[model samples]
Target: MSAPSAPPLKLLPLILANAACMMAMNAFIALLAPLARTLALNEWQAGASVTVAGVLWFLLARPWGRLSDRWGRKRVIATGIAGFAAAYLALAAGIHWALLTLPGILAGFLLLLAGRGAIGAFYAAIPAAANAMIADRTPVERRAAAMATLGASSAIGLVLGPSLAGWLVGGGLVLPLYAMAGLAVVALIVAIYGLPGGDAPLAPRDATPVRMRDPRLRMPVVVALVAMGSVAIAQICVGFYAMDRWGLSREHAGRVAGYALTAVGVALIAAQVGVRRLQWPPHVLIRRGAVVAMLGFLVAGFTAAPWQLIASYFVMALGMGLVFPAFSAMAANAVAAHEQGTVAGTVSAAQGIGMVLGPLAGTLLYGIAPAVPFVVGALMLASIAFWVGTAREPAVARPADEAA
Candidate 1:
C-alpha cells in the first residue's frame, strides 16, 4: 500500500523560517539610508554594503542547495538560521561600537560588509531546502499551490519587516537589527524542533542529474532571471524616480517608495492566494502574468503623479504575483525528485544574479533618464511573456499521491 501524504501543516515551520530570514533582510534594507548616514558613508558605499550580501547569495546558493541535498533539509535550514542570527548580532554590535568609538569609517564599513556577506552565505540554505521540502511533500498538481504558500509567507515578511524597522528605528538604528536577530533566533528554534527531518534522495542513484543548461530548464530559468531583475530595477529606481519626477524631498520620496512596495506586497499576496485556487498550468500563469506585469511597468514609466505611479506599480506587482510562484513550480516540476534541491539552487542563483545586476543597471540607466529602467523592465517582461507563451512545456512525471 502507498504511504499516506503529509499534512499541509508540515510546511508551517519551513514557511515561518523563510519569513524570518526575509524579515532580517528587509529590515536591514529599510535601514540602509540611516546606516549610511550613521557610518558617514556615501550613497555608493551604502549601496555596496547591501550589494555584498546579494553577491554572496548568488555565489553560494547553489552550493548550499547541493549541501541540503547531501545533508538533511531541516539540518541545513536550522544551521543557516542560527548563523544568520549570529551574524546579525555581530553586525549590530560592530556598528554600535564604531559609532561610539569613532573608529576609522572604512573599518566599520568592512565589518558591516563581512557580516552582511555572512548572512547571505548562511541564509542561502533556507530557500533551497524549503523549496526542496515543498517538492518532497506535495504532489505534482499541488506544487504551485505549495510554492504559493511559501511565496505568501515571504510577502508577509517583506511587509512586516520594513514596517517594524520603520517603527523601531526611531529609538535607534541598531534596535531593528537586534529585533530581527531575535526573530531569526526564534525561527532557528522552531526549525530545529518543528521541521521534519531525514530527506533521502527522491530519485534513484542511477538517474541522471539535472543541469542548469538543460533545455527543459532554459525557459523557466530565463523567465526567473528577467522577472527578478525587473523587480530589482523597480525597487532600486523607484525612490530616485519619485524624487526626480515629483520634486519630493528625500523623506517624502522614501515614504512614497514604501507605499509603492506595500502595494506590491499586497498584490503579491492576493495573486498567490488566487493562483493556488485556479489550478492553472504553470506555463499559462507565466504567460498571463508577464503580460499583466508588462502593462503595469509600461504604465509606471509614463505616470505623471505619485498615485498613478503607485497604481502602476500595484498592477505590475499583480503580474509578478502570478509569475513568481508559477516559475518556481515550473522549475520544480521540470526536474527529477532527487534533483529538486539542485534545481531550487539554480533558481535561487538566477534570482541572485538578477538582484546583483538589477540595481547596477537600474541606477546607471536612471542617470540617463528617470523612466528608462521602468520602460526597459517592461520590454523585458514583454519578451518573457512571448517566450513562455511559445516555448514547449517540459514533461514532468506525476507520481501517485504517496506520502512525501
Candidate 2:
C-alpha cells in the first residue's frame, strides 16, 4: 500500500502534550547531582536513585500497558501527567527540607526514589498511550508516521525542558522544579482536551495466540533496545559532558543542549516525512538510521570543540530519529489491533532496560574516564546496524480477526 499523506494538524497537539510531560520529567535530571548534595549523597547514592526510577519503569511498563489495552489510554495518560506534576513539585520540597533538617543523606535518596518513580510512571503515559491513540486513528500503512511524530514530542520536550529549567534554576535552585510542575499542568490540560476519545474495538477472544517464534513481533523490539540505549547514554550524560569538556556554565550548556535537541526533533520529523513518501522499506530505513547514529556518536566522542559536540549530537539524533519510528511501526504492524498494548508494553520494557543499563554503564565508565562510556556506547550502537540490518522478519498472513 502507498503511504498516507502526512497530517500536519494531527501531529501538533498530541506532540505538544507529550512535550509538556517530557519537560517535567527530564528537568530533574539536571538537578540530580545538586539534589544529592543537598541530602549529602555520594555519587553512587545519587546515581542509584536515578537507577531505581528506571527499574520501576522497566517493571511497571508491561503491566500498565496491558491495563491500557484492557481499560483505555487517556485515563492512564492523565494519571501519569498528574503524577509527573506532583513529583516535579516534590523535588524542590524534598531538597529544601533535606537542607534544613538533620544532615543525613538518606532522606534525599528516598525523596529521589519517590519523586523519580512518580515521574517515570507518569512520563510513561505519553508514548505508550500516544502509540495506542495513533493506532486507533491511523491505518496500518501510515502508522509509522504517527509513531515518528510521537518520538518528536519527546525530543521537542528535551530541547525545551533543560533550557527552561536551567534559566529558572539560574535564578534559584527551587525555581526549575516549579517550572517543570507548570509544564506538566499544561500537558495535562492538553492531554485531557486535545486528544481523541475512547478505546478502539478489540479483537475477539478467539484470536490466534502469539508464539515465541514470531520474528514479525520480536525483532523490532531488539532493535528498539539498541536505539534506546544510545539515546539514554546521551540523556544521562549530556550535562556532565558539557561541564567536563569545555567548562561551560550550566546555563550555556542548557541552551546548547536545547539546540541539539531541536535538531534531533527535526530528524524525527524528517523520518515521518520519509514514511509519508513511502520511498523505502522500513527495514532499510531503520538500518540506515542506525548507521548514521553510530557515526554521529563517533563524531561526538572525537569533538575538539563544544559546537562540534552539539553538531555530533545532531548527526546522531537524526539517525536515531528515523530508526525509532520504523522500529515502532514495524512492531505495531506485526501485531493484532487488540495486541497494541502488549507489543507497546514489551517494546517499552525493552527500552526501559536499555535506559537503565545505559546510565548505569555510563556512570561506571565515567568513574574511569568520561570519554570511555561514549566510545563504548558508540561501538555498541554500531553493532546494532549490523545485527538488525541482517535480520529479516517473515510476514504471516493471519485472519482479519486474528490480525485485528
Candidate 3:
C-alpha cells in the first residue's frame, strides 16, 4: 500500500493518455450522425451500442481503480490504452467491412456494440488511475485547481477530436476511427514509458475500502450523475436535432455537429482555465455552473438557427467546465489519501451510469419531440442548481484548509 520507492510522476504523460482517450471518444460521438446513416441505423439502435459500453464502464470503473491500488497506476494505464488501441483498430476494420460488404442491420449493430463494449472496459481504467495519480500529488486546498488542469487536457482533446473527425469523414467514416486507434497506440507507448513505477502510494491505515454510499461522497456522486446525464442528453440528441431543425443531409449535419461540439470544447477549456486561476470553492462552482448550464440548455432547446445552437452549446460547456472538476475535487477532498483511486472510480462510475440512461432517454425523447430532451436536461440542471445552492454543506466536504 505504501510507495516509498516510487519515482516522481510526470504530468505530461498522464495528460496525453487522458487527452487521447477523450479525443477518441468525442470524435466518435461527434460523427454518430453520419455513422448511423452509413450503417443504416435508427437513433435507438445507434444509441444502444453506446449504452452497452456504458454498462461495462459502470460495472468495472471502480474495480479498475482498486486494481490500480494493487497492480500499480502505470500498469493499469498502459493496459487501458493498449486495450483501447486494439478495440478501436477492430472497430475501424468492422466499419470498413460493413461499408464494403453491406452487412445486415442486426449484424452491424452487434459488431458496433461488441467493439464499444471492449473499449469501455479498458477506457474505465485511464481516468480512475490518472485522477488518483493527481490526487496523490496534490493537497486538499489546491485539489479543485489541480483537477481543473486535468479536465483542461480532456477539453483540449474534445476540441481537436471532433474537428479532426469532421475533416476526415469527407474521405470516409472509418478514417477517424483508424486515426483514433493510432493515437491510442501512441498514448499506450507513453503510458508504458512515461509514468512512474511502483504501486500507488497508500498509508496502511488509509488502505481501507471507501464505499460509494459513504456519507461524504453521497452529494458529490449525485451531483456528478445529474450533471453528466444533462450533458449526455444534449450530446446524444444534438446531431439529430440539427439535421431535423436545419433540414440538412447526414454528412452536413455531422459537420455542423462537429463545429458546435468544437465550440463546446473551447468553452470547456476556457472555463477550466478560469477555475485554475480563480480557485473557487467546489460548492460555489457547482451552484453557479448548474444555474448557468440550466439557462444554456433552455436556449439550446429553443434556438432556431444552427449558429445559435452552437453558441448555446458553448454557453453550456462553460458552465459544465466549472461543475465537472469541482465535484470530482470535492469527492477527492472528502476522502483519505489511499481512497483516492476508489473515489475517482466511483465518480466515473456515476458518469458511466449517466451515459447509459441519458442516451436511452434522450433518443426516446427525441422520437417524441426534438426539443424535449434538452428541456428535460434543463429541468435536471435546475434541480441540481437548487439543491446545491440551498442544501447545507456536509462538514466533511469542505476541507478545513479551504477558504469559505
Q: Top model by lDDT, which number?
A: 3
Off by over 4 Å in 3: 1-9, 202-208, 395-404
Better of 1 and 2 by lDDT: 1
lDDT of 2: 0.68
Task: Put down candidate 3 lDDT per residue, 29-114, tens digits, no spaces.
Answer: 88887788777899998888888778888898999888877777778889988998999899889988998987988888988899
In model 2, the runs with Cα more than 4 Å from the true position are 1-11, 33-42, 99-102, 203-214, 248-279, 393-404
Q: Model 1: clashing residue pairs?
A: none
**Candidate 2: tens digits of C-alpha lDDT, residues 236-333:** 66656776778876556555555555556556556555655764556776878888888888777777887887788878877887788877777776
User: Which ranges in model 1 have alpha carbons more than 4 Å from their true place?
Assistant: 1-9, 37-43, 97-112, 202-209, 243-252, 394-404
Question: Higher TM-score: candidate 1 or 2?
Answer: 1
TM-score of each: 0.89, 0.87, 0.95
Query: For candidate 1, lDDT tens digit of each residue in 283-364?
Result: 8899999999999999988899999988998899889989888888887876666677878888888887787778777777
How should the candidates be ordered by lDDT, best one leading? Answer: 3, 1, 2
Instruction: Report the number of clashing residue pairs per model.
Output: 0, 2, 0
Task: Give the Cα-based TM-score of candidate 3 against the true structure.
Answer: 0.95
